[model samples]
Structures are given as structure tokens and as C-alpha cells.
Target: MPNAAPAPGQQPAAPLLGIGQVLARLTTEFPDLTPSKLRFLEERGLVHPARTPSGYRKFSQNDLSRLKLILTMQRDCYLPLAVIKDYLADVDAGLNPPMPGAALPGGASILQTGRRLSREELTREAGATPMLVQDAFSASVITPAETYGEDSLIVLKALVELQRSGIEPRHLRGFRQAAERELGLIESALMPVARRRDPSSRVKAAELAVEIAGQLEVVRSSLIRSALSRIVP
Candidate 1:
């Protein structure tokens, strides 16, 4: 058991908050956050709130800061929990850590942060013509969104360069299929963690899936590099 609440003369060092308040405070920036997701984060040992005498959760300011870090990495950066976990562990230990959502070495990052772009802005930034944009979208190389993201601009820019090499979106139709196949493999490998219905298991499953995908990416890149090693420009 812990010390009883201080008498009327004194308040705790900081006010403690209920789960509802935490959700309300954070939901504007993290719309997908829910009671279950908070519980999921708890189960992963990312944020530990204090327990009331009644066994209810009570979040402190530090807890809120930790949750913000976790949610920002997940939503804005699409970081897998494992990477975020390592980052947080170092931070809690009072060390400087590499930020999350960086690309695995020798690979491209799948997510980005910054201003959202309209179609025209994306095309302008990528220096791509309307016809080329249509071709990329039609090939499903980049999914359409009301407002495009940085990744969309990157893909479009690459398509522009590849176009000058006489390679077009049609030549890259297989990329999507390859991605789906790799995803299927990762999903299959995640069956053990995915079978449980608990929040902890769900979080574990997500991290495992990303780890598996990262491994597959390394292997794919190794093969590509090996194949290119023998080629001459």
C-alpha cells in the first residue's frame, strides 16, 4: 500500500487526472486514442499511472507527457511500438536517444511529418505533370487522399526521375503486388501474438509485425544490392 492522500492543508505535487480527462486532452491530436488503446499502451509498460486506493487509474503530468510521445510517434510517424519502446526506455533512463520513425538503414521511410498538401501542391513540389500524376495514381503507386502527404510527393518525384529514364508507372505495377505479398508473409508470421484478444497481445502483435516487415525489407534490399553489384552503367 502507498501513503494516504495528504490532508486538506496540502495538495499533491501535481493534480492527478482520470482516464476520461486524459483522453479529452489528447484526442484532438490523437483521434484514434481510446480507452483500449491507452490500456494497450499500459500493458506494454510505456506509461504507468498511479493507482488509487480503489484500484482506479490516476494519470500524472509525467504520464501525459509519456503518452504524448508514444502517440506522436505512432500517428505522425507510423513508428512500430518496438522502436518507440527502445526510444522511451533510453529517455526514461536519462539518455539521449535517436528519434523514432527513421528509416531502417539503407531503406526509405514509409511515413513523414509536415504540412499536408493538396493535389496541385503535391504535383508542384514533385515537379510532375498532371498526366504523370494520373499515371502514378492509376497504377496504385500512391493512393489518393483529400490532402496528400509528404510520402506522396516523394513517390511522385521518384516517378518523374524514372520517367526520364524511360521507365514509367506501368513498369512499376508489380511493386504494389510485391508489397502485398510481403505484408501477407508478415501477417502469417504474427499469428501467435495475434491470436490473443488482450490489449497486450494486440500491441505485441503490432510490434512483431513491424519487426518482421523490417527483416523482410533488409533481405529484399540485400538481394537488390547483390543483383546490382555485377551490373555496369
Candidate 2:
């Protein structure tokens, strides 16, 4: 009965509950969540709970808070797993805290304001050369568009920062390959729905891909943070 809900008046100092109790609290918010899914998340290193003497996992308050943040990102932002991981890492390092838009249900921003500049304007604003832009395009890190989107502007800004570190566009070629692989996974997941060719199906597939990507990002970020923990403390 892993999915069984807890009965009323359980002991407050229990300090640990099996997977069933954890789901009882969490499933109300995350309807599609299941034991297997939670295990999948753990397998990817997104979550780590204390093990009981009998080896059953016992989640804590901190684990709940972190799960809330991870789920919020997935339900809201359509960011890729790698990007989400980088963002969570920033927050763990006390750099970028979670945005208000990320916390409220269905409050995700389109992230449109960040792209106020046109491509030409972005190049001027970022102080990046045409060659750099071309390099980014060639690497498939930024797709060709009639106009560069807000994301493109962010990439350009990132490149500017990297330039200060003596890193050039060529150094990021592997990034494009990684992006392709992730996109392939998304496409494969969407294939069944995508074949339907209905507007709703298309929208659903896009949203699902975005959420999956966000979850993957959270997992990646958590793994990196765990690696850094030994030296950080």
C-alpha cells in the first residue's frame, strides 16, 4: 500500500514516514506524481532522503521545501533541465533566489522583458562581435530567427561574461550538441501526441516537454550541489 494515505492523528514526532505518507502529503499538489516517479527523481539524484535502520527512505521538512521548489519550476517554467540545474545551483550558492513568479501556481512568466533589444540592438548592447553571433549560430546554440528572442539576448550576455574569462564562442560548441540531445528526448516523448496534429495536442506536448525539462534541470542542479557539499561545509 505504498500509495495509501495516512490515517488521522498520526504521531507528530515520528520523524520519518515511508513513501506512502510522503505521497499522502504531496499528491494533493502534484496529482500526476506516483511512487515510481518519485523513485525516478531520486534515481536522478534530485532528492536524497535519510534511510531508516530498515533501509526505507524518510523525507524531512527540508526535503519537502526543496521538492516544492523543484515541482514549482516544472509546473511553471519551460526551461531545459540543464538550465534549471544551473539556476538551482545559483540559489544554493546564494546567488539567484527563486522568483515570485516561480512560486505561485500557474504564475510563470513568459520571460519576454529580458528581450527588449532587437538582434542588432542586442549586439550593440552586449558589445559582442558579428563573428561571435555567427559562431553561436553555427554551433546551433542559438537558432536562426528573423529576430533574436529574449533568450538569444541572454545567451549573448552570457557570451560577453565568458569573454571576460578568456572563453570564446568556440569553447561552447559542445553546448549545442547537448541541447540537441535534450531536444531529441523531448521530441520522442511527444511523438504520440504530436502525431495527432491537433492544436490542443501540440500545446500539450510543448507544455509537457517544458515541464520534463525543468524537472531534469532540478535533478542536474541537485547532483552538482551534492558534489560540492563535501568541500563547501
Clashes of each: 0, 1
Best by lDDT: 1
Q: For candidate 2, lDDT tens digit of each residue in 108-156? A: 3545333355667878877888888787777676777766665678788
In candidate 2, which residue pairs clash? Answer: 81-217
Per-residue alpha-carbon lDDT of model 1 for 139-162, expressed as tens digits?
989887888976688789999999
Best by TM-score: 1
- Model 2 residue 39 CA deviation in Å: 4.0
Instruction: Please give the distance, in angstroms, between residue 158's alpha carbon in candidate 2 and its true position after superposition.
Output: 10
**Runs with alpha carbons beyond 4 Å of true place in candidate 1:** 1-114
Q: Report model 2's TM-score to 2 decimal places.
A: 0.51
Off by over 4 Å in 2: 1-14, 40-46, 52-56, 77-79, 82-87, 94-110, 115-132, 144-185, 191-207, 210-233
lDDT of 1 at 197: 97
Q: Give the TM-score of candidate 1.
A: 0.54
